[model samples]
Target: MASSSAPSSAASTAETFPAGTPAAAQIFTTVLSQGPLTRLELARRAGLSAAAVTKAVRPLIEAGYLVEDADTEARPALGRPANLVRVDGGRALFLGLKLTGDQVFGVLTDLRCRTLLARHAPLSDRVPKAVLASTAEMVRELLTEADGYGVRVVGLGIAVSGDVDRAEGVVRYSPFLEWREVPLAELATAVTGLPATVDNDVRALTVAEQWFGAGVGLSDFAVVTVGAGVGCGLVVHGEVVAGAHGVAGEIGHVTVDPNGPPCHCGNRGCVEAIAADPAILARIREAGGAEADSIDEAVALARAGDAHAREAYSRAGEAIGRGIATVANLLGPERVVISGEGLAAYDLFADQIRSAFAAAAFGSAARCELETRPLPFEEWARGAAATAIQSFITEPNRP
Candidate 1:
């Protein structure tokens, strides 16, 4: 069996993960997501015998990946109390990046998804060449910072806002980045000399949520991100759903009105047509409430109680709500998490979203909880890191 101990190489510092064995991986994953578990409880949850649990944990414990905490008060009346096992966050490191139209946001995180440092730089050019250059610079900067930790950077994950083929490490298409069929993993590896994984930003965020945030322990949930372009990530049966074509949960393009507005996708009245940042800005401009140059200006106007700006946001909310309802009705997710830059205007649209969702949902679908989580750009980068961590553990031999 592969040892759970991490490699000592400065470029691959993550725990060895012992993922070759299904039981070891399952036990570690359980603890990583819902840990501080007693040996007996772990055995029960993992559907393994007490002996198997002990056998699996020993290597992890020896590697400093899993730590045992004594529980004196929990001592059983008949026998010794079981100690709890938990992941040691500081033992490994990973890097993540979120590639936007005009900027690349990056972060270095420990195994626990905690951000250690963040860096951002503008993309003066959007072409693949320019973007790759910027990404290499940012990765170099983060790698320098990692040097101080005395741990290797195990993986690099890049999240873009578009159709991403994670398994193939390809960017099928990214509207914002104007990229098509970019072999990002190969390019990134050549530049940074680190293993790379690419994924849709929202899907990457879903991974982070699955492992460390709101969706933890939930088998089915949806993460709806509203910003530059509306995005959704679906988790079904305890796994992130990447459709056969690498596109799933695309709530942004869900048509809300055939006569609404023209979307860049050559469609009429897409949810994105009415609610994305550009659409919101265009509506505010047409309404003549403010001389807004961007979404920020429009948000400022709404915050100042401009009726036209408020109405625009309300309309966006309604469209978003309708789209979310579609997701809930079709998938019946346990929860729908709303996030992204647009949450800055959440107060303006929260009511409309709730009301529209209530009106459109069918029966118990309305009971699907709607939650708002305000996460910074670094969180997206952390999501990328989570993907890298996943690949490192599950497909170490992937090239």
Candidate 2:
């Protein structure tokens, strides 16, 4: 299910995106990402003719997607002030959901992918049916919230981990959820009464990072997330690499140690096998049965100088560092943004990660900037909203 499926009879009547030329979308995106610019600057950044930018901006402005304001600073240089065009963030709203093993994170965002409100619910089960039921309830609540803003909720985006075929809206397989060939977008749309996009969770976050966060203005970058799972998302040549098979930048499965540990993907010595939360816990238990019921307790144990707990985190950090090295060597991205839940224990293994990454990185690839940005689960949901905004503007007729 890589393509949008037609809504069933139970679907709600959703509004359609405004019609515009292809350049209109690009022009709007340029403004959306690096906006509030003069037409000349917009054209320069978007690689379009000034006339083309003007032509594209008109329809978007009329449709309320773009708005122009006089540039007060440009007035003195010119007899008339130049107008700056930008995305009108309040024109529409979107819904984004990040589904995790134990929780469902939901957020409402506007055109700029700013979170208006967020909600989370515990998941008692990971079955497709249960997930859909929870998602529908969250969507309904967000829709009610959208009423106060008086803008249509344009689309919905759901982010899940593992092999997801975004073009088909299918989950080829998700080990976290134990899902197989699930037509998630179709089912999600049916339940929520809106067009839906299903994507790999990390890739969804990469979208947010690319447009609104650390990745802005960079043509090539990578996002490596560590937590329950080690996941990677890459942008090369200004486009997210989904690979020909919709699987790419899977640094978690990168073989850091051939003799390490068993991965959930049935591979040995994979980075995720050693660095993910479960893997760390297993390693901790193996040493002294510290009996840590949660990551927090495990963190506390390590902070308190428990050699066993500290060693578990050190190994996990080394694995993560090597994984980051692999990405740098292979792609030479401008930067690597490290985030996710695991950063909570950053102090425990920050040195190990940096040292391992530095020792393993090949030559100038070592110059690749590595930075950590602690992100809450709500931000991941906002990433989902970014994908929904993307679909709304670019694939309005997806179904």
Candidate 3:
């Protein structure tokens, strides 16, 4: 295992990844996610020849970044057998952070994206300066922790909500953070002395899913998060779709009802207007079934068998289902992974979501599987780390 306390210069060295060889990167990435593969399997997965796989694995093994494990079963009685190749998780370390409106959550992760430690601090203010200060403090604390492991921290990933331009690391507009046009990557790099990658939180999460979670091996999938807001991340043609304007899968703004409640986006009947946490809370209050001021209160009331609260959740689920159906209709994704904080109330409206989706789906579109997985805040931070990994590998040639 590489020591986390390695010199800063060593950390910088890891960032100098070899380029101009797509096959090498692809082979390494394949092993990183689904490793312990023989050379033949690596070639098959990476669509490369055995010679190409051998060439790619050579540098990685020489750098101590990948290891070959002997498989006793694969070894013949006397002859040698091919070894399985896998990435060395302990070879490097990374920092990932998720920036919410009121808090900054951070985590230290290994190359396998395993969380080693997590830290969080509340945000007293959402101003760019305040957020940057809080972020710097958080990074400092994590870096100190990294020092004990004797491994270099090579990169930092910051995940924020809203219109984030990952290519440029600019947050064009974030309603929750009340930020606009913030050059977050530059600011963060300046403060932390590490290369930084900033991305939309949902898209970052989607990348994590594509590499290591439910969306693995799937060319087309959608992740719909229901929580403080409704957000969607889409993958088409084996690539995350960021759209032309850096915003593509804003399913929260998908219109479900033309005459429904108004949204913060100044629209009516958006999915978020009906299904987000605040929307649920507002609906509960309007129904007068409970004196709830938040989603927790509403969930409690519904759990306690309050009919009005139950009705509110049902309506929200219907809206969410409709929004998901819109994504399915347009993209024809093979599967949709439903997640987010609002899944805490999944039982309250799961049926409604399924039924509404089934009803709204046109033709075979309903065949798209909808699976729910609850992702905690730490996972979001991990998604940020994945973005950092992506940048470390792809930055040199990114358009």
Candidate 4:
């Protein structure tokens, strides 16, 4: 018997973005990020003439990718001088998933990267096949949610930790997942029947920050993540720097202590060894003799006036600070945004972090602004979705 409602299916006819001309995509992106502008302002911002902006906007407006409304308040007495134009965020949909050791997080977002709904599924296994199965299931659930918006889901993005080759759509190596050389994009496309984009989780999040969050309008900035892992994402000249080998920003691997502790990467006293959650937990257990099974327990112990626990966090903070100083010295970014799961304990050692950074930073590098933000876990998923939107705009669809 039929129930009160019907079930939603994952089957979707992937649609192509209608903006074919370079100028059209450029104009659409301008509206997507900084929009509701008159043709004059849009032309100025997009570096095009009024005639060119009008030419590029016609197709997008006809295809529903853009909408124009008369500025009733700003109207001149002569005629509808210049109307305001903006993107229709509800025009399309996407799915972004982030893979962790124990969980797979998924988010459904609109064309403008707005998170409409989110879902979490347990990753019981780390094998490529198992992870793919879990990912496909999550995608199906998100697709069902997308049915509510009555839009076709056009693209999929998967963000993984460790070395990922976005152009090649392969995860070269993921330490946490124990995955190596996984052709993630091809396999995922086969499973879910949507064009897929694969990227490093941190780099993908850096893209989101550059466009919609902290890094907006800054051509030079760095994103440092702490907690489960210490990762850095760099942006220079209005683009995320992925390095020649696609492993550019491995700040956590910087050697801070020559003889402090051994790292999983076979290095001694790498920043991650001292600052990552596992490292801090180990320090609390071994040196402090505290039975702190997780970072939360360690944080609680420190807050409860445990000197040993406090010392562990301080050491982690010092390592992180030194790492940031290295980034500043090398690239001279204007701002550094520090985030990640580890920041939940910022109050424990914020002073130590700032002190170490100040002492190590050199010359004008010391003037760089350090901003601390704690993004909700779901934002990572949205970042993955943003990458899909990026691929849609920059590159054509692939099976």
User: Model 1 — TM-score against the truth?
Assistant: 0.94
Which residue pairs clash in candidate 1? Answer: none
| TM-score computed on alpha carbons, candidate 4 | 0.93
lDDT of each: 0.88, 0.88, 0.88, 0.87
Q: Compared with the true structure, what per-residue lDDT tens digits does model 2 show for residues 90-192? A: 8888889999887899998988998999999988799998888878877877787777887778789999999999999999999889999999999987777
Estimate, for each residue in 217-303, the C-alpha lDDT of model 1 and write its tens digit.
899999999988899999998999999998899999999999998999999999999999999989888887778898888888889
Q: What TM-scores do the predictions have?
A: 0.94, 0.95, 0.94, 0.93
User: Model 3 misses residue 30 by how many Å?
Assistant: 1.1
- Lowest-scoring 10 consecutive residues by lDDT in candidate 1? 1-10
Q: How close is candidate 3 to the true structure, as a TM-score?
A: 0.94
Q: Alpha-carbon error at 110 in model 4, in Å?
A: 0.6
Q: Which is superior by TM-score, 2 or 4?
A: 2
Off by over 4 Å in 1: 1-9, 13-16
True lDDT of residue 209, candidate 2: 95
Question: Which runs of model 2 end up more than 4 angstroms from their true locations?
Answer: 1-14
Sequence-dependent TM-score of model 2: 0.95
Backbone clashes, each candidate: 0, 7, 7, 0
